[model samples]
Target: MTTIKQDTDIPRTLQGLDDDRSSVRLRAALAAGTTPDARFVDKLIERSAIEPEFFVRDMLTWALTRHPVSLTLPALLRELRSQGAQARSQALHTLSKIGDRQAWPSITRALLSDGDDDVARSAWRAAVILVPEGEEAGLAAVLATQLGRGERETQLSLSRALVELGDAVMPALRAASTASDRRVRAHALATERLLHDPDAGFEFAIEEAKRVVALGGSGQEG
Candidate 1:
């Protein structure tokens, strides 16, 4: 049985990257993507665009998945704005894993429907997680736009994120209940109502308490 080598071998193991064996080079590139070492990251970014084979490029993108969120997210965001489909898709996939506010500009900008369904879907999913925890206007805008496009997954994911953000999203959540899309409206309402039911979701309950305190807790007195 052939054992998979550890990432310790990493970039060095893929010595065949420029060799005749495509699989060898590709696997090596993917392995190199794991290290948080600064120099290795630069090498991955360099290879992301120039790698000859499509699958090798995919492996290089996969490497970015394990990179530090702070380092990898910024690089991936930059990649998202590029015109190449592979560059955008791979970067989107990695950012979805890290999901931070720093990801907002790129992911939110690409949230609209234009060309690819999967890429659009991935963008919405990442946006739902990465947007600021309390940016109601921004959250509503992204959700409303995607909801208008009739993507139920987008609506559901956004509603779930709003729920995760606590009652700060209540105003927007309430507004979303009136969305033009019935599915969006229903999902938003369900999320809003969950606040009153502790058993509905533990995370929602914790977030609700945090939101209440953040709002000065005056309402809970009544």
Candidate 2:
């Protein structure tokens, strides 16, 4: 918990990030963010890619956001191409927190539909936050392709992302509500329900959708 002030403290702070104990790493990440030094940016990003502890990785992301976007953007964008899943997921998460539209181009289709659930969830979050105006529909269409993917948590992430697009996602949701895959139809219906009524919980909406789909309905009122 030492305070970071002098230039000499930089190297120690950098080393603390890689310390064996998670507490040391946590304090190091906190110090990096507190000081907001450009020198700490790269190291913070690198640690974010592999940090095992969720809290520490979150702190690492906070530290990255503390730096100039110009310094952090390129490095984070490079992380998207990393072979590591955590690397990609953490970078996307940081980008979403940064909320800079300039990072939108990096939210590629591949990332949106990434094979890894965590990576794809992160990408969905980043995409919704960074998607530019006049492109929500296209983004929603692409997001629709992911309906019925993964378990409940993953499905909820996709639903939330689609719901965030507002009315622009309606067409895609409607189309998916009739997909040959019942899971896709159920997910789409659940998402559409969430879109119209935000208070409807995902569990409730999805269970209702499943019933409707089972009865050969699309949850679309004719």
Candidate 3:
């Protein structure tokens, strides 16, 4: 049932990924993923780095995930070193989705604490996903350093990442809860609360932590 449209789909789809309109690019990414061709891999990674729209970039990541890891892993690891922040963030996001442990070694401390909040957030997510066995404590320690680093969204991302490491993060959270910076202490307490009660929403945990910090409590109250 191959029609002329089927025959032409490959070239048209590749070109569509670069179309001026984002909708076109989005469809192009979808098409590329729907029927993956190795030819689409490099172009997908390139476009993911510069794609302005979040949805489009997300589609691009989805498309990359559709490809084989052997094809995607090296390119993604190289992207971790890319000078562009979006490239690094997108690569980390994509790698997290891939869930390939082989990519674990590339998740370095510098990326975990990247100056850019988005990059750091993506790194935190990827690190949690890719962290090797027996490494959770070390990873948690590094993640704790970013406690209270940015705005609410960034702090929430950090807290969730720490919480994902499970009880292995307790020592780090305990140390951070006693830090001189009130913001860090509050964030640590909030993260500890989430670790204990997963159902407690971040907003409530953080507000309650703020109250504890205000009262000079580390939230380890008996």
Candidate 4:
């Protein structure tokens, strides 16, 4: 168990960033994120340039993840505007992990025009998961559009997210099972029993229950 020490000295932690060893600087960024100070937020953004290590930058993301996602997302979006692909990629991966639906609109905008297929798929999936509860039709529309354009992995991710969306997704799920692509239809069928069989839902509800001593709890053995 790696217990993080509350770094009482800010100057000392900053000095660690200057160490000749890259690992030392990475650990410093990781520790600084957990600090009670907001100033470290600016420092992380600055170090984003001076630090050449991807792992270090990823650690910086992990540190930023500690803050309220609202504060970090706008900055990450700005990073996406730059020509540097690594920063844009790392930012998207970070946003996806935070999993906040509040960023759905931005994710949707990214998916709508992103030239890269992977980035579009990731943002599309994130948008589906983030849409507010009252917005199933909207979620389904976006999801269906993505399914229409997506590769196998994107469709699978959409299917799983739809399963989480529950009954609100049945209409779309039913439609997906009828898509022109056999692969899409097959993925839709993976979730079919839940839509048609009420007993299937009940079985899943207590799937972890102990083996029945007698089927249907009968008074007599079978």
- CA lDDT, every model vs. true structure: 0.58, 0.95, 0.95, 0.59
Give candidate 3 regions above 4 Å deviation. 1-7
User: Candidate 1 — which pairs collide?
Assistant: none
lDDT, candidate 2, 1-222, per-residue tens: 455345777888999999999999999999999888889988998999889999999999988888999999999999999999999999999999999999999899999999999999999999999999999999999999999999999999999999999999999999999899999999999999999899999999999999999999987776
Candidate maximizing TM-score: 2
Q: How does candidate 3 fare on TM-score? A: 0.95
Query: Candidate 1, residues 158-221: lDDT per residue as tens digits?
Result: 4455455555666665665555555445555555656455357634533453354355442324
TM-score for model 1? 0.54
Candidate number that wins on TM-score, 3 or 4: 3
What is the Cα-based lDDT of residue 198 in candidate 4? 37
Per-candidate clashes come to 0, 0, 0, 0
Superposed model 1: Cα runs more than 4 Å off: 1-30, 33-62, 65-74, 84-86, 99-101, 110-115, 148-155, 180-184, 190-222
TM per candidate: 0.54, 0.97, 0.95, 0.59
